[model samples]
Target: MSKEITSRKDDYSQWYNDLIIKGGLADYSAVRGCMVIKPYGYALWENMRDVLDKMFKDTGHQNAYFPLFVPKSLFEKEEENAEGFAKECAVVTHYRLKVNPDKKGALMVDPESKLEEELIIRPTSEAIIWNTYKGWIQSYRDLPLLINQWANVVRWEMRTRLFLRTAEFLWQEGHTAHATAEEAVAETKQMLEVYADFAETYMAMPVIKGVKSANERFAGALDTYCIEAMMQDGKALQAGTSHFLGQNFAKAFDVKFSDKENKLDYVWATSWGVSTRLIGALVMAHSDDDGLILPPKLAPIQVVIVPIFKGEEQKKAIDEKVSVLVKELKQAGVKVKYDDSDNARPGWKFAEYELKGVPLRIGIGARDIQNNVVEVARRDTREKKSYPMEGLADSLVNLLNDIQQSIYNKAFNFREEHITPAETWDEFVKLLDEKAGFISAHWDGTGETEDKIKELTKATIRCIPLNNTKEEGKCILTGQPSNQRVLFARAY
Candidate 1:
């Protein structure tokens, strides 16, 4: 029954690692920079994936998978992208491995099995996907190709964390093609909004919708739109990103479409994605020292019914009541679990459910049943109240909705209070070091200045918020003329 989690205040990093392992989310794998997502963790990811899949379908995007390996030639087609990911690319040179002739029981790459051309495990799907698009598009009729792929990608990260950064991770990358730059830009912005909506509504994590500066923009993209969320440790997490490729991939792969006038033009393109790192974001944003605090909408088990009983007769009565309650709750479209197993005591089950971040817990006992009441516990506020069982299902639904909004509001308020505005260099550094949230400051609009600030403070510009007001002010670092302010923070 002990909550053996590291205190967040003492060490945020250890707290995160402890919560992931102790809460049964994920564990370190034999691979250097990869993780084994346990069933409980995978279940959470599945719920997130199902919701995002439905959202993409509703937005005119169809799910179609692409190859995981890209030929070296096709991958290097886009020079900027190739150079950007060159450091992290994992290449396959030999196709087969054989037992060593000299060293018994040891496997070695067979010299005769060398491939004609090397292959690049996909870091992103732009190159291979655009190569395929070359054959798919011929006329203006194929104007917009809204395609999304749910797949795993490799990026050979040296410094790895459970769900945050790993060598290989699962993600959904959306690659779309358009006939016009305008349409492609619109699509990029649309997907950004979708991501923001999902983060705020489903994950109960508030985010700021913004555009990345040139230095922070994605490789081969003209503009990168992103949603940034502030974690409990006062750091920024890039929750999701949408890139406006602006025909970079199209031109590289010779993906052209003939207009009605018979003139061929390079097709415009966009790519946006959200990875399992979001699971880390959710944990950091609202989780307490006790354990995770998953939002109701995203939790695999929204409500868990834990029955309290004594002997055979009381246990039978509690089991019967739990069955009826479970049926009623499921009928009302609620994800509920009846944990009647006696492997653990009631107290142990309560602690386990809390660690798992189940939004609500209902404890029904023989005494409560006789009194026509049940004890309901809220994870977010850690509040418990007894209510009659007559209209329990409906009341629980409403309570879940309230908890969702409450969690969002709490995160929103934290972000609001933490964004400190700085007008001078001294103030910027002081706020970044002392108060560690977001620094809203004017920049000289140069990558050199941004790089200098990052070098000094370890804080980068999180984003230049979309629709940010244009005000005449001096750059906080350079004392040069500036128009609008950008957000800066140390990020994950």
Candidate 2:
């Protein structure tokens, strides 16, 4: 029943680590940079996966998988992508292991079993997918190959966090091929909107939809559209990204199709993905020092009913009343649970659910049952109210909706306030150090200035917001001519 999480204000990093470990979401694994997602965390991911999978299907994407390892030659086909992920790639040089002759019973790689060609564990699937697309597309009719795969990827990150940045993580990647540049661009923008919608509606996290700068764009992408969300710490987290690949992948893998006009042309491509790192964004966006504060829409258990009783007779009475309420809630399409077991006490159960981020907790005691009332506590606001049990199910349903909106409004307001405009170099540096949120500033639109600013402040351009207003101005860092302001922030 005691709150043991580190305060976010005192130490944000430690607080995040504590919540993930102590809240039973995930734990550090035996592997250096991997993690074992516990049941509670996997349940959360399942709900997110179900919703996203349905969305992909509704948008005409079919689920299919490819090999986990890509041949070295195939991986090197896309030059830009190859260079971008080269350092993070894990390669299989030898296929077998044998006992060390010097140290009996110890095992070591068998130099004699070296592979003829090294295999690269996928950091992303563009190379392998495009290579296969070569055979799949022979005519314009097969231009749009909409495929999605839910898989695990490895990026050998030296510095890792529980869910934010790990060596291996689960994700859903969508790779689609189109016949024309315009169609592929449209697909890219469409997926960006989808990510923004998912973040706002389901996660109760507000995000800015924008296009990444040239230096920040995805490797081999002409343009990268992203949904950037502000964490509670005033830092930016890229919630999702959709890339317009033009004909890069097609040309790299020599994937071409005969057009309807009897002309041969390379296929255009688009790829977008969201990963388990979203779980980190969910925790940092709205969670407080107490624990995670999940939106009602995504909370695995929307309502948990705990009975406060002294003896078996009182417990049975409370259980009888809860059964009716649970049935009503389930009929209304609400995820509800009745905890009547004696493994834990009422206080312990209350604290446990609170830490788990359950949206609503209902208490049914002998007195409340006698009065035909129940005590309801909301996780977002921590407000408790006594409501009549006659129509409590409907009341709880409406309250859940209210909580979802309330959490979103709170996050939206926080994000709005954190965006500060910087007109001068000193102001930009001051804002970054003092405020630590999104700073709107004019850039020279050159990679040199972008890289210089990052070197000086460790802040990067988050995005050039979509539909950005046009105005002549000077770059805050280099005093070069500029047209519009882009968002800059220290990101995760």
Candidate 3:
């Protein structure tokens, strides 16, 4: 291989950095905190988008578009949201730029050109979207307006990672309005379930479905539900979130609808989204020392065929055989690629395909063809076996399905094993410092306790898991009366 990958053991962060760059997925851009997603990375995103789009459509959601910029006046209407995102917002203060008088081939912000009101590049589309929804709803008949938008958003983060915390990233936000608070809350949890299902089944990443604590909740939201996933390095990533905005945005934007009984009431709202940061979660969850090990369902190219040869005659023979296999696999509904490039040897191609995370690879040589058998390698387990050419297509289809399930099961098991329940402050602190995974502990249900825990350990209450039973006990830190246990972890 091209210099063995930085072992995950040596440095998990460095390993991820090297893999993203050397695997031909993405590159850092000229702009700080931004990245250029290459063809390979974009293809993977396309696969994710396609699958998510279908799920949204199947659930009675319609696609729509919203403006990219939110005027200062509109943004400030929701004070809580504005304050929450202000620290990370990109603002457009000037309208134009002109050539610098003292410098050659340089431009400067024109002093003469300034916008009437500075526009805040959206970290999320709530303010602008709610303002627009005000005009669309005048009566209860307009209730439950479920809409989703696929778009790019900008956030001026202090630190950025390739896919996790980039300044600009792609995501689909679902903004829905309902007539009743109950309906809106139900919509929020339902969407959370959707995200969990997508993560576990499609991405092959197991997640814990739960509700965020008040301190960890989305700003201006009554409740926030999330799907939290664990990475191989024992860190946690919030895979997706769904928030129930109970009359917050509606009151901010003056979105009121008249009921059938002539009563005017504010609309109830819910907003949920899963961003491209999911790509990072996928990498950290399943990748190994060699390279990425993508789930078969999410892999852009499910299979790659490498033809081995020493001469023109052997090349001709392998090409013919590959052509037949390609046609058969395609007909069987498999995403397959025939790589006959003479620029690289079979061994080199093997490592290349593995780095790209193609789930299955087929290798054919003159002897193998003569024997009516071909060697197949799996990316997940790095296992190779020879199989007869007759039923090769069927075998590959089955193996891909198996890989997808196996990855999910492995992650699920890891998550199950790391959940530790603590009853004392010392134990909790020790778990946060040494274990570095999810810690379940009793809380007094006060924001003060949550904030103090974060101040002391830099660990936050990730969530209060769904269906948690209430048990009378003392708080882990305060030794005060408490009712239930909440999940804690240092999150991404």
Candidate 4:
């Protein structure tokens, strides 16, 4: 199985790269900063996407798609958003490419086909969606247009990883139009809660629900709510974000609706999204040096059964019993696999499944069949146990549930232990020099102070936290009077 992954302790960064490449999750593509997600990895993503799709639908949001390209004029309508993404925007200057006249078999951009107006590949969909909303809304009845789009966006990132950051990536963006500021704000907070719930419940990763600092807010948003999770290395990852756009987009695009009083006003807006970067977060938070530690709820294969038999006479008997057990497990709503092929040894399959992070593994043999029992192994704690075949399916289901909880508990404990607080500038610098996980320290609540701290430490304020307690103290950096503490960490 060649499970030669680098030790996380030796080099966390290389360890992550080794896991992604050798674990069969993804591979580098011909493109410099893009990757090809393997079937194993794509299956993981499909499971995550399925759960999130249902969650969005249950919350009264409908899926609808918009254009991938935004006209340069429309994108510039919102000054802040345009300026924020301008550096990463990919532009289409010409319509077609022609064979080079000077060099045969080479293609060149056709100057004659240059477009009158350039189309910008969307870094985010806010500009194009809001422009279309101008035509979709005519009255109050059209308010609260809850639309979600599942698509890929390009950000032109210079440094790229398999899933964390790339030149292009897949994500779901929710852009909604609201009738009032209160509703928009409420929607933003609600989505943040949904993201936090999904992260903790399905990903088996705990997160901090908080409000982004002004300097950290979304480009055109008045307020940005986020769920931040800590990886095993003590770095923060922004799992998801929901922004209260306040009337900025609506005013920029002139999307107005008439109220019951017959007065017209701009619509309130919100945008929230979670990307495939989440896959990276899940891997970093749990997995060991051997392989991935996928949560049962999101694992494509929950349980896999491997047969340990010598010959056809013994294998046939074991197969008969294993087939029935497989059906029972599936009927019980378990994702189970029975590996009956002779192409590889049971040892190889075991290592492979362990590397894939299958929640549970079952081994059945001729003697075990005669004894009416099978051996089961738990991936999280690597504990092995024997159970009777009579109710093995039911017992395995319960075991999977426990594994999910156990993973979350371990991660939560790690996160709690890493969150260190510092009162003075010297202590803050020392703590961040170690960069255990998070630094909760008082800030003067000014962008200048935030920028200075980041410049000196390369650690930005992750968030202010929701419902944060107020306390009088001096700022860690400026020594100015402060009221509340903010979370500081180097983030992905």
Candidate 5:
């Protein structure tokens, strides 16, 4: 299985595809530009989703579902948002399909059953959600409505990757209503912090907390806050985003509420989301050429124990010891699996679990058990050590925590090394091509300059770092006066 994977040094793109396909994560689906996340991948997602869902609840948010299709009129309520997604929107015009008369066994859209109004599959849920909010909010008592939905969205992308840019993918979108602009902005920043924390703590991937420039902001948004992460290939990925929509959606949908002062005004709004694309980020950021290097916190199988024995009697002895260890690990709240199947050799099982990115693997044989020790291998470092069976479960608990931090530290160090400063146009271009990571350079703060830079080098301003320092400098391209530098990268 490991031989089937392409080395990252040989081809980064192919390497990613190889891992996703052969590492038991996902497969190309029958649907065009879509993927089928396999059981292993879905289990990983479930672990991630469970952690994030609890974080949302602890932050005073509630889960609620909404309609999958939005009425065309409602979708068009916000002109900028509608125009932004118009090219990708999939419309439903007919309610039913009938068998074609000329071609037997073939189905065709029944013209007579066409609906009076078209429905647009939601690319984002703001339009439909705010329309519903109009009926729900009527007074100051209903000032802040914090809701999140775990569902799938369609964007109809021309090109797609397994977990990165599919036409339809699973995600959790949070739409919120506040009574004032300040409140909405606060919510936006808060969610950005939440995303940054989640990416760093749970995913074990370091991210930069920043705000997007006007040209890159989400459509119909007053401001967009985001977290950016760098992959091992020196490319940046937008991990998550939180947008402050001001009163755009509220005004477009006429969602107004009365304050204590008896004044009626459109509600302020914010929306934020993180999707399965994070799975892509995780794979690219940490995995090696061998296979995936999943973080222990989010890995489906955090620990796997493989037993080695020649005959039934030996197998029974190893099983007895392993059963006790597994029970202890489970009691300690660890996701540990004992792979004692007879179909495969011990070495094959080791490679299979290693390719799957299990954080730690324990190998026990008759001799090792008699010696009162087991061989433990660390997936992140590929280091093996022997430990006594007694108190082994408690030791594994501490080791998992260490592995998580070690992975994050390695990624964080690489990111720190890749960020280089550019002072001139030639320098910026040279750095982008030769270095291929984040280039911090001054900008004239104009859309034309941003567009020209992207056209020239395919690098856009990922974000203006939050709380960025004020400094005197000249724009790298236009040589115009500038106040601060922003991060620029060719991204996914």
Candidate 6:
């Protein structure tokens, strides 16, 4: 490797920071808590968005846009949500900037231009979206209005990382209105499964599908379903969340629909979202100390062909072979890049692409061209194999798929190995401090115990496994009788 990254074992956070900048993904912006996602990073986001947008459309959701700023009055309508997000909101008090009369070469907020009510930049679109849904949903026929919006949201965070917890990030929030509670809950879980499938199949990150506890639920939601993925550092990241909002938003906004009998009732609601945070999850889940290791399905450039030459004749010959190979790969629906740039050496190109996480790399040198073979390298394992040009396209496709499956399997196995069941409080605390993965411990099903555990260990109950067994035991902390074990981990 020409340039090495901060090893994950040395410092997990440092490794993540190094990977994002070194991999050509993103960089910190001038603004505090914000980032500038570069072309490669944006391309990865586009791929994720395109696939998810299709999934939503196929499932009967239509795209819509909502205002970025919410009136403070409208935001306060939902008391619980307002309280939950109050500390993290960016408020605009004035609309104009004026030249500072007391200072040279400076501008400041015009005190005279302050509005009657402050505008809160949306941390989420629920308030503004629900207020608009009030008018669109006046009858039973409009009860199930499925809408999704792809937008950037701002959350004023005290500390920020690139995609994980940036002040501004891109995400898709799906807000739907349903007539019945059962239908709304079902929609919530359905979208959770969609996120899980996308993460596992496309991003090659395995996730656990479960429900959030009351204390961990979405601000205004009745219940929250989530897909939690374990990062390589053994910390849990909530990859995505689907909220069964019940009638909270509708009630807050007075959004009502008439039933078959002509009785007016509030609409049941569901809101689900997956953000650029998934990009962070992808980085930590499979990337190695070498650099990023993008899954083939989501890699912006799935395969790159680097042609090597020592002379003009050799260059001509290699270019000819590369052109043919590129055509074949394109015909097979593979995204291929032929890198014959004279500015960079073969060794430099190899290190660059490895950092950028290209799944497959093909090197065609003068000697290899003579042998009618090209050296192919796998990003995941760094395994190199020389294969004859014949049937190379088909082999590349298979190898890409194999790499995808291999990454998922590796993550799945690692997650399984890290999940340790603890029967005693000492063991539970010890595991949280030492191993630090998913700790399955009986919780007496009390929010007080949950809060105490979180206070002491900085670990929350991530979820109660979907099909958890009813094993009679004592609460790891409270000593109260418990029926089942819940997964507890310090999460991102």
- What ranges in model 4 sit over 4 Å off? none
> Model 1, range 114-209, lDDT digits (tens) per residue?
999999999999999999999999998997999999999999987999899989999999999998999999999999999999999999999999
* Stretches > 4 Å off in candidate 6: none
RMSD to truth, every model: 0.9, 1.0, 1.2, 1.0, 0.9, 1.1
Compose the digit string of candidate 6's lDDT tens values, residues 304-336.
Answer: 999888989999999988888899999999999
Better TM-score candidate (1, 2):
1
Per-residue alpha-carbon lDDT of candidate 3 for residues 1-492, written as tens digits (9 for 90 to 100): 384689998998999987888777899999999999999899989999999999999989999999999999998899999899999999999999999999999999998899889999989999999999999999999888999999999999999999999999999999999999999999999899999999999999988889998888888899999999988877889999999999999999999999999899999999999999999999889888889889999888999999988899999999889889999999998999999988889889999998888899998999899999999998988899999998999999999999999988888888888889999999988887788579989988899988998899888888888978988989998889988888888888
Error of 4 at 264 (Å): 0.8
The pairs that clash in candidate 1 are: none
Please give the lDDT score at residue 322 for candidate 5.
92
Question: lDDT tens string, model 2, 85-171?
Answer: 999999989999999999989999999999999999999999999999999999999968999999999999989999999999999
- The candidate with the higher TM-score, 3 or 6, is 6
Worst lDDT run of 10 residues, candidate 2, spans 1-10
lDDT of each: 0.94, 0.93, 0.91, 0.93, 0.93, 0.93
Worst 10 residues of 3 by lDDT: 1-10
Q: Where does candidate 2 clash, by residue pair?
A: none
| Each candidate's clash count | 0, 0, 0, 0, 0, 0
Best of the candidates, lDDT:
1
